[model samples]
Structures are given as C-alpha cells and as structure tokens.
Target: MSSEKSKYIVSAEWVERQLGAPGFRVVDASWYLPAQNRNGAAEYSAGHVPGAVFFDQDVVTDRTSPLPHTVPSPEFFAAEVGKLGISESDTIVVYDGPGIFSAPRAWWLFRLMGAKNVYVMDGGLDGWKREGRPLQTDLPEPAPADFHANFNPYAVTSFEEMRGIVTTGSRQIADARSAGRFTAKEAEPRAGLRSGHMPGARNLPVGLLSTDGRFKDLASLKQAIEDAGIDLSRPVVTSCGSGVTAAIITLALHSLGHEDNTLYDGSWAEWGGRTDTPVVTGEA
Candidate 1:
C-alpha cells in the first residue's frame, strides 16, 4: 500500500493489489436519497468488496437531530467506528455504490473525527464491479477495534456560521443541488421545505464536478469552480440537499489543494426548513 500523502484517491487496480494489507480498512459508505428507496446496508450485504464494512450513514449520525445525516459528536463517531473495526491509525478507503457521492461524506466524517489517513476510492464499488474486481457475498467477521477520537471543528460548519456568511458574504457558499433545485423551479424531494438556496450561495451542482462518479482532474475542477463564479482564493462552504453530496465539492476542493473549505453540516435541510432563514431563487 502507498503512503498516506501519496494516496488520497486509490484506483481499482491499486485497491485490488492491497486487498488485505495490514492497517488498511475498506468501508462501503453507500447512502441513497429517500426518493430512490434503496437500502444501502442490504445492498452491501448482497455483495461488496471483500472485508468491506458497511458504514450506515443514518445509523451512525447524530440521531437526535431533526435533520438528515448530521455529523455526530466525536465520541459518538468514535464509538460507531470502533464497532466497525476502524481506528485512527488505519488507512481507510471509503467508497459508495456510486463513484464519488456519499463516499466523500464518509471521508469527511473520518477527517472531522481526526483520522489522518482517510481516503475516498475514486471510482467506488461501481468502478470496482465494472472492472470485474473480486467481491464477496459473505461478510467478514472483524474483531472490534478501539478508535481514539479527536474532533476537528474546522472541517464542519455550524448554522450560526452559515447565517453569518449569508449576511456578510465573506465566505463563498457553494450549493451542490441541481440548477433547478438551486433556482427553486422544482419542488424539493422532502416535504415542508422551501425550494431555493441559501442567500448569496452559488449553484455548483456536485454532479458537474465528476464524470461517471469519479471526480474530474484538477484542471476541470478549477474550470467548474470558476464557471460557478466561486472565488477559490476566498473561504468556501459547500452544501447540498442534506449534507451528503456537499462532500463531493469538499473532495474537489481538497483535490485542488484548497484546504480552507468547510462542509455545511445542516445544509439546505436546516436552512430551507426554517421559516425565519432567508432564501433566494433564480438562475445566477
């Protein structure tokens, strides 16, 4: 296996070579939209990379929160990760069913919980499966590990910080929702939520940053961000329907070496559902 500094994104070929390396943990962080009606854990059980553990986003998150997939407390995260046999020192490669969707969320989650060697598999299981990579139907029985937790607040954004950004426009807000959703032309998939975006936010639609679930190269990522009118030199906060796909933007920013980006934990779920928070719609 490659060192941490050289391997933030492992291709299918590389992952195949390091299938059972020591200190390596593969996690299937697959999550889906409610409308899709897909069960990530069920799919994971049916087939997954050998020795891969299922990281259930809903079950592992802040259960007390009304919002979806809120980042849990560091203690909570550590406890859950420990059950999955992951530790701070492990080289974790997280992947979802799709290429780069929910996997980045898992990557971000580990990073926030102080895992220095976390990574997102570029093509994910889909890529692995497409390349005819080996998979196992029977789950591996891993001994539970003790994961030490350290919280990094800089990787997360609070509602208060989001509100401040809305007023000051100091930090550039990048919305990962589709252009229609960003413009309020289409109804939200969730009920009782406003259709639009946070005020002063730019619509970057995370899908545009990747092709077939894998992220675009650095040059394309730069173009995409610039096309969205985001000033990369300034601070950036990424948001999506909830907070899942926002991590795609976070991943892209990190790939570009923009380390100042933060992911809005509440995202549009908390913002749009609140009657008091400001909302604006229409093409940018």
Candidate 2:
C-alpha cells in the first residue's frame, strides 16, 4: 500500500486494496463542529467504506469529565474499542469525512492505546467517494475481539502539567485554533471561555498544516511550523479548542521525525474555560 507524507498516512487507493484483509480494521473517525451542520454518524449511516466501523468520538470518551471528548481510561478504552472487533495487533486504518482533520486524533489515540501500525487514510472518505471507490450502506456485524490496552500515560499532557509548561516554558505550545480565535478577534464557539491562547504558545492554526483535507509534504510541514515561530528541535505540546485538532499538529511533528512531543489533553477547553490559567490575545 502506498503512503503519502509518512507511513502512518496511507492513500485511499491503499486503503481500498486492504479492505477486509485479515487482521486489518477500518474505522470512520468523522466528527464535526455544531456550526459545520454535518453529522458524522448520520453520514456513515448513508454510506461509508465497506467493512468500516464508526468510532464515535462522543461515546468513546471519559464521561466522568465535564470537558468535551476527554480521553478515556485504559480499561474503558479497551472495553469500548474491543467491542468494535479491534485488537491491539490489528492493522487499523482511520479516516474522517474531511480526511486529515479528525482522523489524526483517532490515529494518535490508537497509538496512545498501544496499537502499532495504525494509519490515517489520506483524503479521508471524501476523497474515497470522489474517486468513486466502493462504499456500503450496510453495517457489518463484527465479532468482538480482545483489545488489550497498553496505554502510554505520558503521551498526553494533563492540566497541571500544562500549567507548569506555560509557567516554566518547559515546552513550546502550538495552538491549532483559527487565527481569529487565537488573536481574540473572534469569540470562542463555546460560551463561558476566555478568548486567545496560552501566554507562550505559537499560533500554528491547523489550517497551515494541510490543504483540502490532505497533509502537506515534510518540507512544507516544517516550513509552516517554523514560520509560526516553533523550533522543531525543542519539545512541543499541541493544543486546540478542545483536544481534537491538536492531533493534526502532533501528526505533522511525528511525520518530520520529531518524537519529543505530546498532546495536551485538556487543551483550550480547560485553559480558556478557567480563570486561574493565564491567557493572552493578539498573536502568539
């Protein structure tokens, strides 16, 4: 199967060829903002890749947390993903409606949960459909498999850890929110949250890292990040409005062979929503 930027990102043609291959699993990881007016589940019900299962981001989260889409515990993740007939050893490929958007989050999560060889489908289902690849409206009843969760606790940065990072500048913070939101020129979608970003954070805005739902090449990825004032050699922690799009930055970093990175699980949803944490406006 051919890949695009990295081995973790496979082309739609490759994914189509791997359909129903033994120990290969496909997951539709589509999600959208309320303003987008798109329903991932409803769209999946209409039609999706054959033998693909939906990974409901809303349901597969830490329900106990007040925040939206918090990463669930290892035990909880194991139980939920196991029901989808996915094992840690399986060659899992995840895709979203807009390709690289939400798919990287699933790819990050799968890797965090210790599923090696996980990949994101380049161009997503949108590209798959545009290419006129096979799609099925019928949902397959997959036999449940044992998904052993070898969770890596260090992959995610906690609120407290983020606080220290901001205070000490221990790691460079790369925010994935839009330029308007990051600069406090636009109101945050979620009410009761402050506008702007962390004090020392760089405004990478996830859009800079991709084009038409596909990630940029390694050189372009590096250029976009460097233009945003981020040093690839230093440690970085990715953040977003919630924790979703931050993964796109994480994927970009990983694609460039930058391994000293982690995703802040709480992100702006926790930082901007709180009065205790510091927030600033007007670029970086």
TM-score of each: 0.96, 0.98
Best candidate (score: TM-score): 2
lDDT score for candidate 2 against the true structure? 0.92
lDDT agreement with native, every candidate: 0.88, 0.92
- For model 1, residues 1-284, the per-residue Cα lDDT tens digits are 12222236778787778789998999999999977787789989989999999999998888899999899988899998899999999999999988788999999899888899988887888888898999999988888999998898888889998899899997999999999999999999989999998878999988898789777777888888999999989899999989999998888888778899899999988999999999998986
What tens digits encode model 2's per-residue C-alpha lDDT throughout 112-193? 9999989988898888999999989999789999999999988899999999999999999999999999999999999999
| Clashing pairs for predicted structure model 2, backbone only | none
